[model samples]
Structure formats: C-alpha cells, structure tokens
Target: MAKTIFITGASRGFGKLWAAAFLEKGHKVVATARDLRSLDDLVNKYGTNILPLQLDVNDRAADFAAIAQAKQHFGSIDVLINNAGYGLFGSIEETTEQQAREQMETNFFGLLWLTQAVLPVMRAQGHGHIIQLSSVLGLVTVPILGLYNASKFAVEGLSESLAQEVKAFGINVTLVEPNQFATDWGSASAAVTTPMPEYDGARAWLQAAASEDKIGIPEATVPAILQLIDSENPPLRLLLGKQGHPWTRQVYEGRFAEWDAWQEIAAAAHGK
Candidate 1:
C-alpha cells in the first residue's frame, strides 16, 4: 500500500535517499531540511508527490508547525523518519558544553518533540511507524565521537521505551543503527572541536581512518527501512550494515562477560 511518509533532514545523505526511494515507489513524501532551497532538486524530480519544507529540528516551534502542516497537507502521516541529526566529532573532554547541548538538542530532544507532535495523529488513526536513524555508536563507544555517541545512545534508549509505550496505540518505533556508510556525513554534517595536544595521536588516527573510503553502502539501508515500515511486527531496534551486527554483538558479549566476572562484587553492594 502506498503511504504518506514524513522525513527530516531530507536534503542529503540517508534522508534524501529514503525520500527518493519512497517517491519512486509512488508513495507520498513530506520531506524537510534546514533550508527549503536545498530540497529544490527533490521537488523538481518528484513533483507533487514530495512536499519540501524548511525545518530545523532543534526549533520546537518550527518542528510542531511543520508536523501540523504536514498532517494538514497529507491528511495523515503513516510513517515518520527522524533523520535530522549531525555528528559532533571530538573527545568528551575536548567538546564544549554548548556543542554537547546542541548535539543533544538535535539528536535526542528534537526526535522526542517531533514524536510527541505526531503521536496524537497516529493515535487517532490507530497505526503509524516511527523510524529513528541511530548509529552503531549508540551501542558502543569510540574515540573522537563521544558527544555523537552519547546523543545516539540516548536515542536508542528513548526509542526502546517509546516503542513499548506506543504499542497499544498501534504506533511502532524502530531505531536504525548503521555503521559507517559512504555518505558526506563525516565531512559535510560533522562539527569538529579545537584540537588538544594530549589527544593529537588519537585525533590523527581518527582523521586517517575517516579519510579511508567507507565500506557500507547508503542505498543498501533503504530496503531494510522500507521493510520495517511495511512490517506488522517490526523490531524495536534494527541494526543495519554487515559491520553493525557483529560489532554490536561483540559489545553486548563483552558487557555480559564483564557483568559475569563482577557478579559477586556487584551483588555484595546490596548487603544481601
């Protein structure tokens, strides 16, 4: 069935690809970017099937207004792809308070607000899918992306809780966790902090690693997302890409191992 899909950060990267994919499948798309002009090409190509709106997720008023406009324009929004987030590349110590706040505002709080706005409509209709674009970093930590990792971790936790809360209303929430994909995400959407002498070696390593070509293909994720949208029993968390699965498994296994090793000590704290 053709559905009305609402997407954020649709000017480029995964969001752009998803919007195009849906339009190609003859679905209605309400795509948004920080700048409306950035979506001119999408508007031109998809024509009336795509509604390009200007939106900065951090702006609560703008988010609400956009969601209202989208619901009004399309009559209903069957799916919401919350892909409006950017990376803040830096160690936790190096990242500024303001930068961290901005990261949380966009990646976590913005998603929360938009989901809140759409819940009423979804509840009224009794069915909807909310897809959140998280990352493998959400499951495991890495250097030079502490803030980004924190933001995604928050998204993962929030989305999991949201899924349970909205299930009774027939609203599904899925957190898409993808590893490094071949996108301008690391270059165009990334904000870097000032360098510190102590972290020079780690920073150099990260820079070199980032310069290498990414292994994951952005388009490969489209099918998974589409499947999630159409699924009657979608997972609360869907890890995309080949690397994401093994990497996440490794993280969870290591965590379990540590928990088992420290079980006696952990239990002692309860004074049992």
Candidate 2:
C-alpha cells in the first residue's frame, strides 16, 4: 500500500517530519516548500521516492501546475496534506488589513486552490484523502492570535462543506486540529504585530502559556497522522494534544449554554 502523498510546506515542522516518515514507510512523496533547497536532506536520503518542488502556496497558478506535475510523476495521488500555514500574533484591534489578508491568502485560499486542482484528479481515480492542518485555536479562540484563529476557522468551515460534497465521490476530508507545539510557528516563523499597551493585560494569558510544559513535541504527532492517513474511514476531524480536548470541550459547553440561554430570543426573532 505504497501511496503517493502530495504534501505542502514540507521544509519544516509537521510537513518535514511527516514527509520523512512517509518516505521511510516507502510511500512516494511530492514534497513542496517555498525553497526547494530546504528539502535537500529529504531528497538526498529518499532519492527518487521524494520529489521536492519549489512552491509558494499563495500562488494559485503554481498550485494547479504542481498538482499536475505530481500526478504525472506518480500517476496517482492517494493523499494530500495541507500542512502549509503560519501563525499571526496580534490582538484583533491591533491587526492590520495587510496582516489579515496575507493570513487568509496563505492559510485558506492556498489550501482552497490546491484542493480545487486535485479534485478532478481524485474524481477520475475514484478515491482520495485530503488532510487539512488546522489548529485547536480553530475550535476555540485565544487572545493575541486572532487572525490565525480566523484563518483556521475558515478552514474548519470549508472542510465541513467539502466532506459532504465529496462523499459521493469517495473523497475523504479530515481536519487535524493540533494545540501549541514546540516549534517556531508562533515565534521565529510567525508574523508579529506591534503591541499596544491597551491589550497588554489581555495578552498576559498567552505569555504565561508559552513554556515547554504547555507545548507538545512535534515528532509525537507522526503516529497520529499516520493512523489518520492509513485508515479506510477517517474521522472528519481529529484533535491532537492533551490540551485540545479540555479547551474544546469548555468552548463547546459554553456555546451550548449560550444557545440554550438565547433560545427564547431566537424563537421570538423567527416569529412570522
């Protein structure tokens, strides 16, 4: 069962880890990154089993072309891992228009273009699996990470609709929602906005949460991802990390409580 896996953002983080894992498992991987040189080690080790491509996920044209190239190279793509995105650190009031746009462009639009490009190929083959790399923040919002939360929320909603639309086509869609990890995602790799004194108190929770104890090991996610990809019937959403469950449950419970509290208002508004 050596399937071809087309992975975006393969230079580092989960992308790099998963690409190497899949290669070690004898699966052909089309590894893409902004800089192909970043993937040199994977190529050097895995040889022809890995096709390292230079890709800026924001480019729609490049996404389609990359999909075509991968299909032509492997003859079939059994899975797609959209692991390409970065965190944007800023309070909602401090976020700029450019910051919001760029965040959406890379996280949401980029994944959309690639998914659109791969649809036809998967349809023809009659089966495929698409794994979206969302965040636990996608389920519950946190201060200082507003824009990143928005992008992942968009991903969650898009994937929900997509799963229903593609079920008849035998395509499986899964949203992998992971909590904070020990990575450069929110540090060196993130885009930080100028901090404002007004939000300093609001941002304290984030600063306090930034420690080794709060983050999971990036490599620990490999087995969870492998099980997800290898399953015949994968779940629509998979939450990773010990922190994800409690946070998500609390958010959901609060939402239900609010909904129940507002039921009367909702009914009154619906009255004809």
Candidate 3:
C-alpha cells in the first residue's frame, strides 16, 4: 500500500533518511524543513511523490497551515512523524531563560501544535499513526544535556497520554526513543550555552565517558521505522538502539530499589 507520510525536519538526520526510504518504497512524503532549499534533491528525484515544504514548527499558525496544505495535496495522511527537534547542550545553571523558552517552543510546543492540527484530519479518516522522535535521555538523564532531556521527557509523557486518548478513534501513537546515533543532533543542529567554570569537572567527566563505538548508524533505523508505520498494532513506545532497553532497565531498577526501601515511610505519609 502506498501511504502518505507527513514528516518534519526532513532536511537531515533520520528524517531525511526515512523520507527517502518511503519514497523509494513508492510511498508519498510531505517532507518539511525550516529551509525549503534543503529538500531540493528530494523534490527533484521523487517529483510528484514528494512535497517539500518550508515549516518552522514553532509557529502554531504555520503548523495548522502546513497540515491543511498536506491534507489538500494528499487525499489522506497515513502517518505523522514528529522528527523536528534540536538538542540544547548545557548544564541547568548555565542555561538562560531565553534558551530554555526557545527549546520548549520548538521541541514540545511545536509538536503539540502539529499534533492538534492533524487530529481532526485523522479523526475524520478514523485511522492514523503518529510517531514521536524522543531520546534515551527521556528515560535516563545525562549530566550536561539537561534541557534536551527535559524536552524529550515531555514528549514521552505527552505521547503516552495521547496514545490512550486516540486509541478509541483508531489513531495510534508511538514514541521512538533513540539512543545516541551518528546524526547531526550534537553537532550541526544543537545549541550550546556559555560554559560555567563550576561545571568544568562535570564536563570533563562527560567527555571522558564518551565512546564513538557506542554510536549507532543512523541509516540502520529506517527498516525498523518502516516496519513500525506499516504494522496494524504498533507499540506505544519503541526503543531504537541496542543500549536503550538495558540502559533504561538499569535506571528504573535503581528507582524501584529506592522506592521499595522507603516503602514504609511513603505509605505512612498517606493520611486517611
């Protein structure tokens, strides 16, 4: 079946890779980027099968407009992939108010607006799959990537709730939680705050712990993503890399141990 997939941030990273994959598979793609020119090759190669649009997901009006345009162009949208987000690399103390606001605007609010815009369309059709691009940081935190973790964590919670709410409408939601990959997330598409001297030790520790071998290849995720979108029963949450499951398990196991140890105190605190 040739499905129509509406995806944001299709200029690069996993977004571009997946867009090309779908087109190659004879599916139609409405690929969006902040800069329309970034999608020139795809537009040229795929021709009528691909609609390259300029979209800044932070703009609520633009999100609605883009959805309308896509719905008008393609009779129906089979899938919506929220892959537009950038990383904010900084400690909590180093992060400024403006930077924090901007991160939330694009990462959380942007996805929220687009999802809201697409809901009516999906409801009318009575079928759709929404794929949210989250991160391993959403499950477990790292030292310097605080804001990025916060944004993904927000997506995780929102998508979980959305999955339940839309199930009766025949709309499925899936959270794709990817670990570190060979993507532009940390380099080209990231914002870095001014370094504070107080966090130098923590920065050194983070740097020392970095391992290039652990980074998964971005291209490897396409098949899994395609399989997910094609399935009649997709998971509410899907972890993308080898480390995501084990790493999250360890983190949660510790949480469980702590909660169990303090179970008596926690129960006593509940007043009748």
Candidate 4:
C-alpha cells in the first residue's frame, strides 16, 4: 500500500531525508517546516506527490490547520512523523526558565498537539501510524542536555501510551531513538547559556563535547525509519545506531532493576 505521510520539520536534516525516502518509495508526503523556502527543490523534484507546507509545529492553531489542509489535499494521512524537534544543550542552572519552556513547547507539546489533531481522522478511517523522533538522551539523561532529555522523555511516555490506547483503533506508534546523527540539528540548535562561575574550569570539557557531537552524520537513521514504516510488526521503540542500542538497553534494564529492588519498600509505603 502506498502510505500518505505527513512529516514535520522536513526542510532539512533527518526530516528532509525521511520525506525524500518516502517519496522515493512512491508514497505521497506532506512535508512541513517553519519555512518552506528550502523545500522548493524537494517539491520540484517530487512534484504533485510532495506538498511543502509551512508550519510552526509549536503553534497549536497552525499545526491543526496544516494537518487539516494536508488531509483535504491527500484525502487521508496514513502516517504522521513528529520530527520537528531541536537540541537544547545547557546546564540546568545556566538554562533560563523561558528557554526551557520554549524547548518543551516545540519538542514536546508540538508533537502532542499534532498527534491530537490527526488522531480523529485516523480513528475514523481505522488505520494510521505515528512516528516520534526521540533521542537516546530520552532514555539516558546527560550533562548540559537536560531540557532536551526531558522533552524527549515526555515524547517516549506519550508514544508508549498512545501505542496501547490506539491499538484497538488500528493506530500504531513508533518511537525512534537515534544516537548522534549527522544533522545541523545539533550545532544549529545548540543552546549556549551564561557560563556559571562555579564551572569555569570545565568550559573546555563542554566545548570539546559539543565539537565531537557536531561531527555525527545522519544517513543511517532514515533507513531505519523507513524500515519501521514498512515493517509488518514494527517495534514500539526502534533504537538507531550501534552505539545507541547497547546504551539504551543498559539504561532501560538498569532502571527496571532498580525499580524491582525497591518494589517491596515502595509497595509498603503506598499500602500495596
């Protein structure tokens, strides 16, 4: 079956690659971004099958409108990829309250609103898939990237619940956890906050970390995403990159083991 996909933030990076991959597979794509200028080449290449929609996923109204418009244009949307997210890298103490909120609004709430907007139409037709672009950080928190971790963690939870809630409706949800991909998403969205006097000595450490992360390439991720889309029994969570797999497994297993170890005490405290 030729799936109709609506992908957010398709103007560049992984989002762009995903859109192109779908188009190559003879599927219709409604590729959206905050700006459509960069999408012209894609639209020209794919022609009618590519609908370049200008959308700020953070804006509830705009997101809803874009989904509605895409549905009307494509007749129906079989897949929705919530890939419009950014990396907000800054220590908790250095990150401003507003910056943190903005990060959540875009990376977390944006997907939430878009999912809600598209659910009804999918439910009515009784078939759909929602793919969330999360990160390995979603599973394992790291220094200087707490906000991004929090946002993706929220997405991971949402994707899990959505998978179960909509299973009866034939709606599937898949969460993609990519390690470090070659995307401007890292450097372009890097958040630099006021250096804390307390950590002045560690500035070199932070800078070196950022420089190394910026070198990762993004080609491997799109293939995995496409495979998930084509898979008959897709995994609820698809961890990308060889490096990400073991880390994700360890983090999840460690958390579960810790929880199990404390289960009796927790249960007693809660009167279970």
lDDT of 3 by residue, 129-212 (tens): 999998888889989989888998999999999999999999999999999899988899999999999999888877675588
Off by over 4 Å in 3: none
User: Least accurate stretch of 10 residues (summed lDDT) in model 2?
Assistant: 205-214
Per residue, candidate 2 scores C-alpha lDDT tens digits across 125-243 of 99999999998989998889989999999999999999999999999999999998987897777998899999998788788876678799999999998888899999999998999
What are the per-residue Cα lDDT tens digits for candidate 4 across 158-266? 9899999999998888998887866787678566677687765465565575555444567766677778888877889887876777766788899999999999999
Full-model lDDT, candidate 2: 0.94
Q: Candidate 4 clashing pairs?
A: 182-216, 182-217, 182-218
Instruction: State each candidate's clash count.
Output: 0, 0, 0, 3
Candidate structures ordered by TM-score, highest first = 3, 2, 1, 4
The alpha-carbon lDDT assigned to residue 170 of candidate 1 equals 91
- Superposition TM-score, candidate 4 onto the true structure: 0.91
Q: After superposition, how far is residue 67 of candidate 3 from its true place, in Å?
A: 0.3
CA deviation > 4 Å runs, candidate 4: 200-216, 256-264, 270-272
Residue 102 local lDDT, model 2:
98
Pull out the clashing pairs in model 2: none
- lDDT: worst 10-residue window of model 1: 206-215
